[model samples]
Target: MSAQLTAPQTPAAAPAAEPAGRRPRRGTFGLASKALVNGLLAISAVYTLAPLAWLLIASSKNRKDLFSTSPYSVGEFHLLRNLSDLFGYDDGIYLRWLGNTVLYTVGGAFLTTVISVACGYAFDKYVFKGKEKLFGLVLVGILVPSTVLSLPLYLLASRTGLVNTYWAVLIPSLVNPFGVYLARVFSAGYVPGEVLEAARMDGCGEVRTFARVSLPMLAPGFVTIFLFSFTAAWNNFYSSLMMLNDQNLYPVNLGLYAWSQNTHQQPELYSLVIVGSLVAVVPLIVAFLCLQRFWRSGLTSGAVK
Candidate 1:
């Protein structure tokens, strides 16, 4: 009896083979499920890409071809000519609008990133009265829709005589509460209290420590916030419409919208609007490609340590 107990009781009879037919059926079911998922994704991708495909084809056509030709078919290969006409129209106002968009997006995103980083760093590294309350207020602002702020912002801009000016747009973009929130998160993850304490022990002043020690670690987060702010300010339309009346100050998005409205009056503007849209997309694509690395690095930086 003792020897049999010590021998592992014949290995427990190997618990029956889970029915060989059931194994094949389970594998088939899994494959069918995978195929179904792949099919759904393909359909969704086609739906999303269909309009974009048409835009590319339509931008290459003249007005006559745009209305007449199949969406995917080529028509006279007028992309270069359409671009020329787009730029030459209204004394090259499209180029002017493009410049304006760059100004707004770049300037606003930069300032917003700086402000956010500073605010977040302070929140994470320092303890002060009402810190949580102030952060809670920032979170609340995030829940408030941007559109709701437009009317109030417009009213304020009108009162200050900033309406129809760059300040009207730039001022609002600088007050990004969401950036502040992200900055705090990044600070908590990327910058350690121990590191900050060491900097303090080294006789470094607060600003000097943050500038030299904390900032480099926070670079990825800054890029992420800047991308968000840039996209928001670049695509901004409702606020710009509410604040600006002058065509000269209109960003590329609003300029495109204006051109769209006039398409019925001048059929050629239809092609210009389509081509101009494609042009507007180029900078964003380039920015995304260049900055995507920073974003990916940021997502994983705080996870490990």
Candidate 2:
């Protein structure tokens, strides 16, 4: 056999090694993105907490320290004294305001949650004429700022003789368009259609089905809505400002605002405002801390099923 005398083939040129400087580094972009996000979050946290920090520090100081020291400085800790004066001021009116705030927030939030969740359930489950149209209207209401509706609400309250009464605030608070929208979303996500069908097959009426099966399943959503409504009603300053002239009906926010306005005339009120504001924040913090588990579950439940 003829020897294979083929010319020795040249080795295939190795792929030119990419320059080390030009090689893509794994995770460089990812690390850069993470750093950027962390930086932005830190900035946002600082911005949000700075005023709160000032308030906290200032609340501990007397008026002299407030003016004499830096805003962030710690002065003579008089927190208990401040609380005593705050609750004792003006015939213990702060207590009354605190009570009113609780009533408005708790009662109104409960009612609002029920109504909103019911409406949302109806929107999701029931097929009625003009259903989408009505929901669209609700969405329109959401687009309309609450401030814009205050005038109309005030006029309606005046005509009905509700102005300056608890009803004026409570009634309007019960009609949260956004809450209704949220309820509908939650209903759609949390409730399965088959469950309703099974309930109906078991001879359960619509209301009975809702109350027993549907509502129980929607607990996370319920707590979420309650928290939102509570926060909104708790901080309901503008509505109270517009609707109420009676100081007796004031919520904590409105009362604190009033104290802030009077601080220029009564220098002692500065301490009151600081301490009152501090007190007002406690409820919201407590609410979140207590109910955060439910809120978290509500947010994540519908995502999967």
Candidate 3:
């Protein structure tokens, strides 16, 4: 017996470990995607803001500098002079236009928001016959071009003797089918049935429940609707043109349009129009800045819930 010639068995070699530095990088793909998205957004932003930048600069330049100088170049700072001229032109009629715009936008937007939100809340929370049918009609109304209704609206206003009156503009502004649709969506998301039921169970009436309980929760929706309606009313050119013949009753946009139309005959009015447009843009900017948070939240209401 040759002392049990059992050879020692060697251990199997271990698999080679991959290098840490050579690991596949996920950050590369992520960074590239982010860069692409950011580039597109930056381009879009420049496209959108360029006109506004032009407007701001042009608003500051005197008439000679407006056309003679480069568009993006700084000219004589005539913003104050231009504003003075704008206010003094035509016996300060620009103020009248601004006042009219404020009146129409604030009054009409408030009423429209109220009506639309109420209708939407009812549509969302209440049970009734023909509810879906009525909402479908609203959707149909949204599809109809606003311009198409202009003739009929004019005729109706004529029949009722509302033509060339504030009512003609304000009345039409109050009927916002899109606002109603948005309100219904917001109501569905922001409001819960249980809270409404609890309010009712506490002997709260329908109107009271809405006013005290639900309306508070619907603040974001209301502000959103109001902003939309306000912008529409502020920029309401065609309607104001058809509805108002009195220069004093014209909103800022329509008044500026009138000035622009007369620019061929009165070259100085070009400056006035430019300056007035800048003034007209201020309120809208302020409103958006103030309500931006609520507006953003309102927009995302139904997106999550």
Candidate 4:
């Protein structure tokens, strides 16, 4: 009886109830924050896409529909008509301009990539006199805007009778300080000393090792340099305008500028110019999409190491 009474004195444990409304409050707050963030992101995405949307819509309109119809409206689809007109204009001069642009971009970019890769690799790998000073000079070149040098380049080209020629544009593009800097960074990260030493042990010459082993590893860097140089050359207006007086030698940028000026008098040319602008951007988009993997991989390769 005493044992039973002692046992009965133990207080009953408190009932374990669900947390009073705290969970619901927290859940509501989280949901509200997420909704706000999503809303903002949606708005930002729309804003970013708006210009491309307008360009796509505008390119589909003819001369009359461009001004009269709604800017965003899907008018009588005239994209094919516009393309035909663009190609047919001035005995297919637009096509010629397109070719010239491709040549300038691809040619200059290729040469620039080669030069940058060689210079950067040499600077990083070879021990030479005044290396720091030379690299410092290159950094100075990077700090100096290309526009500032345009006049000097023009004078030099004029003296050498290289002005008013494709070489005027191409040769200048071949010397990209930024590309060289990027190449140096890439070489330091990707081109390992151990691999180089192993290649040397295997009786590989420097040239052979670079061509076979190092160049393949530097593909990502090369692609990036190529794209940069290509875009720079393609969009180069001032240099091309200053260097090229002949309409036949004009790249798309200069050609478009010429068209833009005439658009004041020939209102119909306005539609063509818009359509041409839209067309011009396509190559750049294609190039980026195609080489995006290399660009991304190149950037992230050294993040861990």
Best by lDDT: 2
- What lDDT tens digits, residue by residue, belong to model 1 across residues 205-291? 999988888887888899999999999988999999999999999999999999899878877778888999999988998999999
Reference-based TM-score, model 4: 0.85
User: Which residue runs of candidate 3 sit more than 4 Å off their true CA positions?
Assistant: 1-23, 296-305
Cα shift from native, residue 190, model 1 (Å): 1.4
Candidate 1 global CA lDDT score: 0.89
lDDT of 3 by residue, 173-195 (tens): 89999999999998998888888
Q: Could you tell me the lDDT of residue 272 within candidate 2?
A: 95
Better of 2 and 4 by TM-score: 2
Score residue 30 of candidate 2 by CA lDDT: 97
How many clashes (backbone atoms < 3 Å, residues ≥3 apart in a chain or on different chains) does model 1 have? 0
User: What are the root-mean-square deviations of the candidates from the true structure over C-alphas?
Assistant: 5.1, 6.2, 7.2, 6.5
Give, for candidate 1, the lowest lDDT window spanning 10 residues.
296-305
Clashes of each: 0, 0, 0, 0
- lDDT tens string, model 4, 178-275? 98999999899888887788888889899998897788878888898889988888888888888899999999878989999998898888988988
Kindly indicate the candidate among 1 and 4 with the higher TM-score.
1
Computed on alpha carbons, the lDDT of every model, listed in order, comes to 0.89, 0.90, 0.90, 0.88
Query: What is the Cα root-mean-square deviation between model 1 and the actual structure?
Result: 5.1
